[model samples]
Target: LDPNRLPRTIDGLINALTGELDDETLLIIDDAHLIDEQPELRALIERFIMAQPPRLHLILAGWHEPDSPLIATARLRGEALLIETADLLFTSDEAAQLWQQAGKTLPVDFDELMSFSAGWPLALRIALDATNWRSALGLREQKSKPALDDYLEREVFARLPTPLQRCLQRSAGLRWITPDLCAAIDPTFNSSELIAELRRRRLFVEPFGEHGVRFQPLIAAWLSRRAAADPEWVHLHRKAAVYFQQHGDHESALYHQIAAGDPAAVTTFLPLARTLLAERRAEAVLDWMRRLALTGDETPELIEIQAAALHQLNRLEAALATYRRAERAFAASGDRLGQSRCLRGQAAIYLDTVQPAPATDLLRRALKLLPRQCGAERIELLLMQAENWAN
Candidate 1:
């Protein structure tokens, strides 16, 4: 039943449509959010929805959560169907399918666009519609960005309360936001009431996991664009870094520190990289080192971390080149330990690439440079030779 086309009563509409429905008919009401404008019509639907024929499914579709008494009653009776934006959003795999169905070559930035859109339905639809998919892979590159932003303002962001609006703008730089995380960034987040209000309104945030909530990516992206222009954005990232550090999520902590753009961000990453590498998160260690060292001050140890990460990701050519760079830097700096580590990184790539003779030679050099105790690297090299000969 719709606002304009209802049969004067909910019962009348049901009786009129009953003869037309099948045993498994599904009825979807689009723009169900519009029901809020006609309170009597919403009440009529709420009163009769619970007893809708068992075989006839009723689906209400809306961008914002429609305020209907039926929602609560439906939930209390276990007859409700709640389809969230995340549920409706297109997945990356689905996006790939759309690409093939459209008969277009996959864009080089396919993964990047998938992440940037966070699988929002509208964004995916827009990307899929592009005549030049490669050029439109970036959200900003899409000519319809203005249309998307305007739609967001009308259907999403404009519906949020004032306090939540401010919270979103201030905390946009954060990837994941919870009440506690916002409290860490914004001193004025007096209570979780702001969160409660958003929940009550059924806007931007999604109650995720057992005790967690996440911002809808499209809404969060708009907030981030606003946040990036604010002077407090740098301060926000710094606060997030500290919070992540306290929680022992060191990888995220280091990323925020880098985003903070403090001159000493480099100093923080170097030591953190050692811990990360020890934890076998070589990719993160390498990324942190490379990003922090981009302005200047490329350390031998950082280059070694890069080599280790590339090796872990199986980019043998790049890893081998980085290992050689590290070896030269270490030799110039007279660091025997650094030289030995570089040799090991090179040897691993050589073995993986089937250059067994070079792998054996690097292992010999590493063992000779390493002290007699040699430890794990020595044991690793001996094992590599054993495996090589066995093959």
Candidate 2:
């Protein structure tokens, strides 16, 4: 066991261990990332892992994924398993069990608790302690119980570098955080480095897609509250709106546009609603309608998009009524194309319900109103007319 006689090769290590024990063994290294700071020790561990010694298991735990070639290579060879933060978050059923174990009936708004906590165990514990639990779980309220704030400040935010902290504060309202979005939020910072640092720190941010990350709901809610009174918040939202719009994420763009208190938010929404309808995301279009309170609008295009969504959802009578409303509005506005589209929508419901005669009449009127250059519209109407005749 002389320190100077340590085995440097896999075979020599096995020989050293052969007479030591006869049973399976586990070797776990917590804060294993610290070992990574020592190149010689890190290389020794890597070699040991490559050896795959008999009945020996090694587990490495740390705040960040290991920056080790052996870890990746072992993973590829199915000799190693890596568990991520997302894997450890509580499921809905697990959260329910937690409530039951606490000797409390599950709250009716348990889903809100789950959403607010984002299944983070620490956040859930904090929420479970609140007397005014509804306010604690309310995202709209954006209230962080003092205990929650204190813990997060001391444990999480305080651990971040100053620049990263500023970046998070500035981009608090953004749902999906990308390097490009971060750059748009604060041009003075090297956003890519800040984002990479965030991921490495494991500071309540999770890798989202190929190029983005998202804050856990509790973190986002807390930061949003802090950013609320900043006059620059609205300006940042405007910049976010422009960024998302340029990136073709119309739904997120619309959200930011509204948050910016932009007068053109509705204009941005109309096109996004139409696009959602066209993409057959009918439920999404309806969700946006309710979210934006667009139901009371008299705009022809808004009515048309809602009607189209209802049509896709097979709410035929509702769709027909809405289409009729849109058709009248279009006619009053002298928009022949809008009127023609509404007629086509009504005819589709009629055709669906086996009312070919009414559908044929609607299609004929639509064809007359539709412009001559509308080849696809004309073809669709002619095809519907032929279907009606066949019926």
In terms of TM-score, the best-performing candidate is: 2
Tens digits of per-residue lDDT, candidate 2, 1-391, equal: 5534544454586656655757888878787765545676676677777765577788888866667887877889997888888898899999888989999777787897887677888767767777656465445454445556677778667755578678877877788788788788777868777778778767788788887888777777677666666778899999999998898988988888777778788888888877787789999988877767677345999999988998999998889999999999999999999999999999989888889889988999999998899999899999999888888
Clash pairs detected, candidate 2? none
Runs in model 2 lying further than 4 Å from the true structure: 1-88, 91-93, 103-118, 126-135, 141-155, 296-298
TM-score of each: 0.70, 0.70
| Candidate 2 global TM-score | 0.70
- Candidate lDDT scores, in order, read 0.72, 0.79
Winner by lDDT: 2
Clashes of each: 0, 0
For each candidate, C-alpha RMSD in Å?
Answer: 6.3, 7.2
lDDT for model 2, on a 0 to 1 scale?
Answer: 0.79
